[model samples]
Every structure is written in structure tokens, then in C-alpha cells.
Target chain A: MPRGQPPLSLPALIYEPKVRGIIFQVLLLAALVVAAWSLASNVAVNLQRQNIASGFGFLDRTAGFEISQQLIDFKPTDNYGRAFVVGLLNTLLVAGLGIVFATILGFTVGVARLSSNWIVSRLALAFVEVVRNMPPLLTLFLVYFAAIKTLPGPRQSIELPLSSFLNVRGLYMPKPQWLDGSSTIVVAFIAGIIASMLLARWARQRQVATGQQVPIFWPSLGLVLGLPLLAFMIAGQPVAFEYPALKGFNFSGGMVVQPEFIALLFGLTVYTAAFIAEIVRAGISGVPKGQKEAAAALGLSAGQSMRLVVLPQAMRIVIPPLTNQFLNLTKNSSLAVAIGYPDLVSVFAGTVLNNTNQAIECILITMGVYLVLSIVTSIGMNMFNARMALVER
Target chain B: MDAGIRNRRIAITTAALLAVAAGPAMAQTKTLDTVKARGTLNCGVNTGLAGFSMPDDKGQWTGLDVDLCRAVAAAVFKDATKVKYVPLTAKERFTALQSGEVDMLSRNTTWTMSRDTSAGLSFVGVNYFDGQGFMVKKSLGLKSAKELDGATICVQTGTTTELNVTDFFRANKLNYKPVVFEKLDETVAAYNSGRCDAFTSDHSQLYSERLKSPKPDDNVVLPDVISKEPLGPAVRQGDSGWGNVVRWAHFAMVNAEELGVTSKTVDEMQASANPEIRRLLGKEGDFGKGMGLDNDWAYQIVKQVGNYGEAFDRNVGAGSRLNIARGQNALWTKGGLQYGMPIR
Candidate 1:
């Protein structure tokens, strides 16, 4: 419209920013395709020259090597596919246990850092600072070498509070042995959970409609826990505990946790908890102090004010960072290789690759598993964060 | 509008040109020639395994395996110092060789069939004969390996020792659990702390561990050989010329010892009346030249590091702290397993 402006041509219309963006993206995509094609051809040529065969058919072959520690039933004669499962389960076991313990320790230390007692707060702060600075591998070595190795032998095991035993070999504890009718108890427990959920929903609706709240917590707890016990009693209480008994040279008739698993779990939990504590501390501090004061102004007790008002808001900020720590813990489980825990990376990536001489395929599968796990975790955490986010009209 | 169209065309053409140029660059190959032209041999050694490959207090490597690495360097450049020792562990060693990070691996590596064929590596020859054995504390009163039926064994994670221990226990119908560690030091430490009932590894390694332990005489290696471990040197499979250079380097040492050409008498042997001794000392013929090495390549190796027997006796045999008798590692003339091929 201006006088100095020249008329735009048809080609200029096609080359506008919006149009150019599409063209640029297409070009980038084409370049990527070409690069990939060339890389594939180069690999083909190299493989031919080196006489190296590349395929996933090796997964069907027998993995002749025996795993030192396996959760699932496995033998050297088992297929490579079975070995993969063994590795996956081992990884999940470590990550799952590490997550549970790290969260507990993290929350306690985080709150203690804000404690009224001077010594407690200082000690929590010192732990966080010291652990966060050291490498996870070093921490693992310290625990495995200095801490666990110092334990007494089987003959001189340290008796814990319970009938549990701790020795240099491993932790020996009483394991639950399920007899007949245990399935009935399990079924009843599931039914109890469903009943509790339905009851809670009904109580919420009733409270909203009549402005008269029902004491749902106690009733729900009773239904969920009491029903299971009632079912067990009616079914003749079929489950029993097998306490570990010391034999001549070793413990027998109970579950034994290997030192490798303990060291890995201990290392991961301590390392990840330091980061989680920082996240928790930051989350609590981020909540405006006015929220707590507001709850107090409403005549709420200190405990109720913090729990009902502060924690809800703090958790909203904490869940996202806490999720990140979870992902980190999962990845760090690969370090179990250092202690020879037979996790996915050590068993599948390291041992399997060595035996099969299929480094590319093995490493790809290992990385792919990790990538899928991370993606799933992130998606799950994002869904949780969305649910906790504040709604504004 | 025309200029805009022209610019777009130019951009597309440039990308296409780059894509075309990348094909040739990616397909290029000449790794073998590059190694030869470099003159200096890249040799992989074990990091700090005593009697195999360990750095001295003065930062120089000294051991039988380290000597093998130097021998290869001497064959290549007529100077034993022209070697760069890339210390590698068991897990990293094969990958390093296959990836061309090291020209040859002279570490105390077991020469297995799978590694020879599947790993794209060629074992030239066996340098030492080793076997897996158990080492336990003297106070345990475990005189024989068979005495401990349910003993927890501390073993290094990735080695033949792991498989051997399992087979031994399985065959004996004994129930034993292994407490595996990635590093030798950690495994030994675990064993010393009584975390494990016994430590299973190569007999040579057990000997080394005993020396490094807090109380050297407090532990003893059991008199049981669990597995056959033919430790040797290896090179990449594709290059026959490079493989010969490495293989002959080892053989030269063995031949020198068999001919009684010690480091002290190598110079005198060069002028000997015996034809075979003269030829071996690089005085009569160009035998070394045929193998792409200097005539005096073997002379340099012996002069710098001594023969194979000397290196063995000094590091791991009767003369060392290990006090291991050369039962199978002795020469053929001495009625032992080490019967090397003739140089000619």
C-alpha cells in the first residue's frame, strides 16, 4: 500500500517465510534420508570386507555362558532370548527397590534439613552435600569394599532386631512360604480394594450433597485390610514363614540377598536420594509461606496445616523433579555392571556381545530398551503432573 | 521473484553435491597401510597385572607380556622403544583390537576358538600356559579345593575363570555360589575380608595377589588346575603381513632362547661359526627381511628385553616371588610343552 513498495511477484509469494519453512524442512528430511542410505551402504561394504555378519538371528541361539545371579530360572542351555528376560527382570528389580528406598530416605532427610533441632538439620545438610559431590561408582566401591566386606562371616553373623542375620556373604532373612488357600486370601484382598474405592466415592458424593462428611478413611482401611485377614482365617490361614537356619557352613531354608544386589541398591538409593532431597527441599521452599499461615489462621493445628495446605502445593512442584530422579535411577542401574549384578547392560550388552561377537546388535537392543523405559517414565510422570496442576477458569 | 527462485535452486544443488561427495569419503579404506607407514607399533597390554603387564615405579612397563609387546615393536622399527602400550582390560581388549585402536594385543589374553574366529582376531601363538586355581586363607584349613562343597568363590567377572569354576563345581555335584567382581583387586579384597570362601583365578594371578596382600604368606593357592588357559598375543585377521610380523616376533624370542643366545652372548653369537646361529643372529642371511623386518630385529629384542625364558623366569617363574616351577612353560629340549617352530 505504501508508495515506495514494489509489486510482489508470483515466485515471491511461493518463497514467503511460511512457505520457505516447509521447503527447508523438506530439504532437511531429504538430506537425512540420503545420509542414512549412504551410511547403510558403507556398513554393507565394510561388513563384506571384514567378513562380519550382522543380523538378529543370533538371538535364537544358545547363550552358553552362565549368569552368576538370576531371578528367573535360567541355565547355560537356555536361549539368548531367555537371557534377555533374566537381564530385564534383574534391572527392574534393582530400579524398583531403589526407587522405593530412595524416596523414603529422601523425604526424611529433606524434612530434617528444615528441622527445628540444630544438630539434625546440620547433619542432613552435610549428608546431602557430601553424597551429591561424589560419583556413583565411587560410592558403590566404598559400600562394597569398606562397608559390606567388614561384616562378620557366616559363623559369626550379626543378629539384627528380628531373627534376621547379616554377614559378609549376604543378608539372610525369613522368607514367606505360601501354602494352599493363599490364592483365596489374594483374591479377597483385590475385592477389598475395589470395595474401598467404591465406598470412598459414595462418601464423597454424600458429603457434597448433604454437607455432612462421613469418616471414610477408617471404614475404607478396615474393608481393605480386615477383609484379607478374615478371608485368610476362614480359609484356615494357609501361609507360613520360613525362618533362616544356620547350617554347618552356610545358611539354609530361607531367602539370601546377594552382596552385589545390596551394594548396587545401596549405591543407587544414596546417590539418587541426594538429588531427590534437593528437589524436595526446593519444592517445599517454593510454596508461598502465606499458604501455611492461611491454614493456621483457620484454626488448623501445625501438623494439619502443613499436611493439608503445604504438602499438596509442594508435591505439585516436587513430582516433576522427582520423576527426573526416577529416570536417573533407572539409567544408573546400568552401573550394576561394575559390581557384577547381571543387569541388562552387564548381561545383555557386555556379556552377550562378547559371546556372540555382535556388538552392534547387542548395544542397539540395550540402548533401545533404556530409551523405551525413559520415554514411558516421562509420559507417566507428565500425566501425573497434569493431574496435580492448578486449574484456572 | 526470479532471484528468490534462483537462490532456492542453488541451495538444493549444493545439498545434492554434498550428498554425492559424502559417498566416496565414507567408503574409503586403507587402515593396513596407515599402520605400516606409522613405523611405531601400537600394542595393547594388561593394565597392572604383575608378571603380565605392570608399570614400574619409574613409569616404565616391565613384565613378560610387556616384553612381547616390545618384541613386536623391535621387529617393526628395529627399536624396541617404538611401542605405545595401550593398557586394556579383558572386556575392552577385543573391541580395541577390532576397532583399530591397537595394532596388536600382547596382553596375557587366553587364545580361545571363539575369539579366534568370531572376534575377527587371529591368535599367532601361545606364549604362556596358565590354569584356573583357587586361593584361600591359610586359617580356613581348606587344604584341597574339593574340601569346600558349598564355598562362596570370588571370581573376576569376565574371564574363563568364571566358566571354569562353574563347570568344576557342577561336575563335582557341589553347590557353590560365586560372588563376582569386575576388577581383580576388588575380588582379591573381597576374598581377603572373608566375604568369600575362596578366590578363583589364574594361578599366576593368585600368586600376584598373594604378594600384594597384607600378609603374603597367609594365603596359599590350591593344587588344582581347573581349566586350560593358553595365553598368547593376537592381531587383526585381515592383514596377513602384520600378523606375520607379530607372530614371528614371539617366535624369535623362543628361538633365541632355544639357540642359547642370551642377551649377554647375542653379540658373540653373531660371529659364531655355526650357520644356524649366524643366520638367527642376522649375520648370515636376510631371513628377517622376508618377513618385512630388519635383519637384526631379533637381535634388538634380545638385547633390550632378553629371550622368552629370561623374561618368564624373572617375572613369574622360580626366580620371582611367585616361585612357580616351569612345569609346562619350559623348553622342548627340557621336556616341556613349549616347543616353538624353527625360525627357518
Candidate 2:
């Protein structure tokens, strides 16, 4: 239409960037749709032809089997769906505890690696190097075998204080049975926590208002412990100990911490902590040296400067990678199958799929669960990261 | 018009590529034909179940189940060595056969009704007559499974043993905990390390597993046969031709044992005038032809892998360290239940 411009045509339109981009995008979408449809149809036809039942309907059937470690109530007569829930809970238990333990150990060892004491730094270095290098599965096996091999039998269980027993089967401890009115103590503990939070906030505000510091640690501890103790006394000390004793073959009447669970937690925590330690070290190192120097110039001690200046800043960098380590620990808990821990993969994917012969359905469900777990973990860590992030005016 | 033509051409090419990416429409080929074309029989067996399907020190598999696979191979290829052994766990065995990863599964798998009907597996026939039992430490001095009231039992997961132990404990009103493991080695190791008070499995497996303990005599199998466990070979269902071939492979061995057609006497007995022996050795009728095999299928099976009696004795019976008696596994003529169908 313009003086020197050629008339718009189909050939010319194809060469245009906007038109080319749309065409390529549409073509790519079409290819993906076709591939996905073909794969699904292929699976369906194969499953039908093979006559192997493929659906989630089998979850309703009676499981007719037993699980060793259950965090919730379970029986052999439970349905497959309930068994799956039991497995999921066990997996969550191990992963949740593992994350907590690994974080504590990781932060400690990471800071120790930078300690001025040579022995402390070298020990931390050796721990991180050795554990991070070996395979998680091998470490699990070693820990499991060590527990199984070294521990004594129930008849000759090693005696521990407070009437606990350690044996090959497990660590049998005295379970605290709470009578009525235990709720009073629980309520007091919660109130103490709330009061301590309020006190710390007030103390922080007072310090900002007037350059004076309040001793929050001892007072907070006193409130927490004293409230709980007073509640227990007022409630007539409503707690009884159920000590485990050998009855027939194993210890009866008390809580038993299974070796399988202990080994799984130990293995996953140690292995995951090694990688987490490196992340922490990198995070701490990423903080500017100027921050520490400024704190010292203000007459703050090394410990105070580290606690007040460096770690807070380092946390922003540490959290994202630390989230990855947590997710990894969760996934690696699947290795519990090797040592007979009744985790999700061991129970649901391994046993249920085999019994039902519904591989596609069982595996799909297991993958979906892990996907959701990872997403939830990512969201939580991201929220925490947001809080620690530097705010701009 | 030229641009439109180019777009059409690109669409057609994309469709063609998509079709290629989606694997070829899997035509249901007869398993026999596929195995023949592949030139080796893919047989799934246990990872390591001694006296049943474990490999020897020389890496040569030698057991009752291994012999069954060899018998099928001998019948098809005329050479017992033309077999690819795929070691599978108890959990992996059925899926391996169902997926057609293996043409035949000769693992010591129990032939349950559910496996036969819904799981899409055709268990050919029982190769080992087994029953669930428990093995406990002799120091525990447990005489019978009844004494295992409050015990913790170690069992391999994905097995009928898990169910049987539960039922046994529940029926007897005994409280027990089950420590289940994925692999047989793990279960046995847990049992040996005193992690469990008892290890329960098929009776034959109990004897075999006891040998794995550091001191075999320190433990003993309790006098308990809780549930019927007829361990056998299985193949994918819906292939009647393939099913018949595997079925008769086992039947041929049993019939040979019944008719006294030992591997040593198979050749000489073929010349004997006994009609039963003649028909069995494939001299009278073309029984193998019905199953798409040579007429001398039974002869080859006998010559290569020996009869059922020899296999039992050599693997799990008195000749082996397991020393399991032929109790209910004996031929029907000898007051046992192993009755083979007539070849004719």
C-alpha cells in the first residue's frame, strides 16, 4: 500500500517474525498433544490386551498383610487404601524428623568447618567429605547391618537408665502414659510459649526505645519450664511410666523404637546433612566481610556479630538450596525399602503393585504423591525465603 | 497457494514423525514364534532361592526350577543351554512374565487362584509341592509354630507367606508382628541377625535358608505346614499354544518319573515294547506336534534335564543338603498327589 512497499502476500507473511513464531508454537503444541495421546492409547490397548487389570479399584480390596512400622492404627485386615495411608504417614515421619535433625547438624558442622580451632575444622571437613562421597544406599546398608549385627538379643538386652532396653529388635523404652488432666499441662506449655514470644517482642521494642538489653533467654526458659512443672503438680502428676519387659519373645508393654526406623533416619540425616553443610558454608561465605567488620567496629564480640549480622544475611542465600536438600532427603527415604522400613515406596509401590499386578496405576499414583510432596515442600521453603529476603524501600 | 502447500507438507511430515514416535502397533505375536525368532528362551527365575533356582559357584544355574526352564529350552531348541536367565525378586516375577519381558517364568511361585485368573498368568503346573512353615533359633527351644505366640516373624514382602503368617497368627489368637523385607536375602539376613524371632516361608525355602545361616544347626524349622503352597512355573495368559508347551514340559517330566523313564534309560526304553513308554517318549504319537514342537520333545527333555524325580532329588531332596523328603510330592501311584495327564 505504501509507495516502495510490496503488497502483502502469503509467502511474505510466512517470513514475518510474528507469523513464524505463532506457526512454530502451534506446531510444537500439536506434536506434544499427538505424542501424549498416542502414548496413553498405547498403554490402554496393551493393558487391555494383556488382560491385566489396570485401575485404582484394587485399592478397596483387603490387604491381608502386616506392616512393621505404622504411625497410625493398622491391622492385617485393613484395605489397600488404608495401607497406603499408613505407608505415607511412615514416610512423612522419617522425612520430617530427618529434615529437622539434618538442619541442626548441617548448620553446626558448616560453622565448625570455618572454626579457628584446627581440630574442629578438620573433623567437620572429614565428615562432610566422607559422607557426601559415598552412596546413600550403601550408608543405609552399613548402618542397618551394624545395628542388626552388634546389638544383643532380647534375652540379653543391654540395660539403659530409666528402665530402657537396647536389643537387636529395637530400643525398648518406657512409654509415658498420661492420665486425665494431662491436657492442663499441654495448655500451660502452649501458654508459656505464647508468653515467651510476647515477652521477647516487648524486650526488643524496649531495647530499640532505650539502648538497654533484657535477658530474654533465662526468663523465657524459666517461664516455659516453671509453667509446665506447676501444671503437672496441680494436675497431681498425671503421668505413669509403662516400662518394657521381655514377656515371650520380644519386649512388651512399652514403646519400641524399631531399628529399621532408627537406621533410616540416621542414614538419611547424615547423608543429606553433608550436602546441606556445603550449602550452608557457601551461604555464610556469600555474606560480605564488611558486615562482620562493621559489627566488630561497633564493639560487638565475634559470636554476637555472627549471630546478629552474618547469619541473618546468609539465611537468604541458604534457604533456596537448603530447600533442595530437604526435598532430596524426602525422596531418598524411598531407600528405606532396602532395610525393610515400611515407607511409602516400600509398601505402596513395591508390595501393593506386586500383589495387585496393576503396575501402571500404582506407579502413577506413587509418582503423583512424590510430585505433590515436592511441590508442597518448595512452597513452604519459598515462603520462608520471602521473609528472610531483603526488603527495598 | 504456494505457502498453503508448504504448510500442508509440513503438517503431513509432522504427522508421519508422530506415527513413528508412537511405537509400532504391537501385533499380538504368538510367544512361541517370538521365542523362536529371538533364538533364546527368556526365562524368569528367582534372584537366589537355594534348592529351587539358585546359581551354583561356577555361575551355572542348577535347581529344580532351573531344570524346568532348561527342559523347555531343550524341547524348543534341542539345546538346554539356549536360555537367558533373568533373575527377578518375588515382587518382580509376575510383572516380568505379564509384561512379556520373559517368555516363561519358572520361579518357585505359588499357583494361587487369583494369580491364575486375574493377574493374567497361566501357572502351567506345580513343580514343587510346598507349604508355609517357620524356622526359629534352636536356643529359643520353640517346638512348634504354636509356641510362637508373641514372636516377631521376618518375611519377604510381596509373598503369600506374609498373608499365611498373618492368618495363622490370627486364627490361633496369637499376637505377632511381621517384619517384611523386599528381598529374600534381606529377610534371611534379618532373621539370622536375631532381628526376628522366626522367619516364615515355604517349607522348602526354610530348609534352604537355614543353610545360609552361619551355623545351620543352631536353628530348626518348626513342625508347621500352615498353608498350601504349590510352587510352579507360569507364563502369560491368553497364549494357549505357549501355555500348552510349558504345561506339557512339566507333565512330560512327571510322566517320565511315573513310567520309570529315567534320563539314563530314555534311549533304551524307547526301544522297549511298552505302549505307555512308547507314547511318552514320542515314538507312538506326534504329541509334540500339537504344541508346535518336534516329536522327540519329551525325549529331549528327559535326556537333557532328567525326569521330575531326579530333579527333585538332585535339588531339594536327600541328594541335596536341604534333605527334604518327597512326602506329598511323590507320584500318585506311590500314594502322593503328583498325577500326570496321559500324553496320548
Give the residue spans of candidate 1 off by over 4 A.
A1-14, A210-221, B1-36
Clashes of each: 0, 0
| Complex DockQ, candidate 2 | 0.35
- State each candidate's chain A TM-score: 0.90, 0.95
Estimate every model's Cα lDDT from 0 to 1: 0.80, 0.88
**RMSD over all Cα atoms, model 2:** 6.9
How do the residues A1-393 of candidate 1 rate in per-residue lDDT, one tens digit apiece?
Answer: 779655778688667889778888999999999888886776555544554546789889987566767888887678888989999999999999999999999988887887789999999999999999988877887887776668888989899866889998788888888898899889989999999999989988998999787888899899889999999999998988899888746787678888889999999999999888888888889999899889989998988886788878989999988998999999989878767678998788766766777666776788899999899989998998998888777
How much is the lDDT of residue A245 in candidate 2?
Answer: 84
- Tell me each candidate's TM-score: 0.91, 0.94
- Candidate 2: list runs displaced more than 4 Å: A1-16, B1-27
Which DockQ value does candidate 1 get?
0.23
Tens-digit lDDT string for candidate 2 (A237-296): 998899898898889989999999999999999999999889889988999999999999
Residue A124, model 2, lDDT: 95
